[model samples]
Target: MVTSGRTRAVKLDSIAAGAVDLAREAAEETAGVLGVGEYLGAYAEAERVVSHHFACPHPGYRGWHWSVTLVRASRARVATVDEVVLLPGDDALTAQEWVPWADRVEPGDVGPGMLMPSPDNDPRLEPGYTGGESAADPEPAEASVIRAVVSELGLGRERVLTVEGRDEAAERWLAGPGGPDNQLSKAAPATCITCGFFVRLRGGLGREFGVCANAYSPSDAQVVSIDHGCGAHSSVPEPERAKELPPPVWDTIAWDETGGLFD
Candidate 1:
């Protein structure tokens, strides 16, 4: 038993060291490859992830660039290094060396409008945007649109709005525009088109925001973000939570008649 315990401790130590090593390597790589502007942009994206995950005041980093390293050196012998170059302000590390937004959406931000399938870029995003959008796609229209899609198609018996509102929103959009007449081709085209929400619920893609089971990948709708309950916002939601997401700003996308989603 004691021998086993020592072995475990040794393994743990290796993993911890590996994590540090991975972070350091990524930081170096980031510094080497990116210019100031590019690094700042990457940092901004990383900051969002960090802020959302930590939910604390910025802790500050030693340099403008930072990276996340995950090393499983013992059992699986796996090592992962994520490089993130931050701008000149705000640090996001905890005393425990944790960056909360590492895997979550930034606390109070929307999607980033980037393309997908390039290099960890979210595939679900439309071709117009630049960076990977955030993971949360909360919108009021999501509820109605998703419901309409599902009701129209008669796909699964799953009910919308059980626990979290996100699920319902996702389901409804997956159903598509026709309500029930148009059969969802291979994947939910209209609903699955957006990338941020895709990662929020469905798993990540090996190449882009690959195949989502969500009904229709709806095109990006314009969602407004005005101060609710403010003087000029009387036209906003009565219940506050029921406010619709700003309509998508991009042009309306046509229904995919070709059958395949990405096609």
Candidate 2:
């Protein structure tokens, strides 16, 4: 994992991967401070009460309940706080009951709704039978889902960094004397809804990324990626506000391979 003080410039994708690892730790730290133990105990009680009230039905019909954990995608860490609730019904959720958690959860937390089977459920090599699901079609990749989530929330995919770099800032702010509060430090947490977790990723003038503050609430889930950029995106920042830079030096490097998701 990349720490605060490395001199080398990390690629966005590489930094994203590293962010997942670091954010998880930060989330766990946050949870510990937020009193996860008390929350979990209450959550267990709620589960029992809810279960007793409505007997679980068969398979998909059952009233399934879940314990919620906050996850920070940047650091790929789960939050320490627990958000236990009875799975929501088809009707819209009450704001009083859920609005407070807007700071930590996101729609992507639910993951892909359900597994969709392909042509057949067979697992073989040839003729009529074929392998069940291809390796390429796994449940969901966090990277792709995150992109969708950002779109849905109207957050930016890019955060601008200082021309210098994060390490120099970290040394002055975090490592030197006064940590984080230093003017150069730009760290913010991104909370997912479906998962109910909050993780902090690095941000600032050097690294250009998006901010999707509108996505903090559960109601924001109704806003799909395709529908973003509409009037509803009032809280999203305009792209013109970001610090501009020349194209990455790497863009001109001879490409041995295409790192893009699609050919």
Candidate 3:
């Protein structure tokens, strides 16, 4: 958030010294026993408004303090308590700044039956040639003719992916399991670019990515990079075939050299 760019001066009231005990009593009462600790300091907000700080003794509220604001009416020497509340200190343990559910959502967080609405001004998408989904009625004859011409040129979509969106998708695909860096690709027989089941994607992504049409591939039906591969590559090597020969004749004719049957 942007700063105010202006500063205001505060006048310290001498009466703050007289009301220190009163502010402490207010803070103690608001915090009850075991909440408030030793006195810290006091500061002035206006002519007769002052606030006193006391360390918070609760273990869960580390680096937090009790702030008791005191106010005085005209000609009154004694100040009465206005408000008492707990405030964080400079080095306090605090939670991260809150983020909207839409902004914090990650990929796959929206499952089936979930609808995550996209903001109209999202940077990832830009208006098509027709300027996308206007609530106004159809335009004049000349404008309709122009729109028809644009539609004939294949620009009929309401919104198109911006350069940032394209780049984001490309990077995500390249880092996923179907990318060249994954274990399957590292030990693959060959890359998908030369595989028979590799179906090249169209448009700007055609040169770098394709769909895996191989049923046996782990990444089947998924987008894979040009260099990504698996054992199911079309031209995997075949095992060596065993050789065959004619059956050999028995050496019965030479068996007489061995003599007796027992032998």
Task: Indicate which candidate wins on lDDT.
Answer: 3
Best by TM-score: 3
Better of 2 and 3 by lDDT: 3
Predicted candidate 2 versus true structure: per-residue lDDT over 130-161, tens digit per residue: 22233225365755665555556545323323
Which parts of model 2 have CA positions greater than 4 angstroms off? 1-147, 151-159, 179-263
Which runs of model 1 end up more than 4 angstroms from their true locations? 1-13, 33-65, 71-74, 83-263
Best-to-worst order by lDDT is 3, 1, 2
lDDT of 1 by residue, 164-262 (tens): 344443444334331222433223323332333332222221112223222333322321111001111212235546767776787476464575777
Candidate 1 has its poorest 10 consecutive residues by lDDT at: 223-232
Per-model TM against the reference: 0.17, 0.12, 0.67
| Every candidate's lDDT | 0.33, 0.33, 0.84
* Cα-lDDT of candidate 1: 0.33
RMSD of each: 29.8, 36.1, 7.6
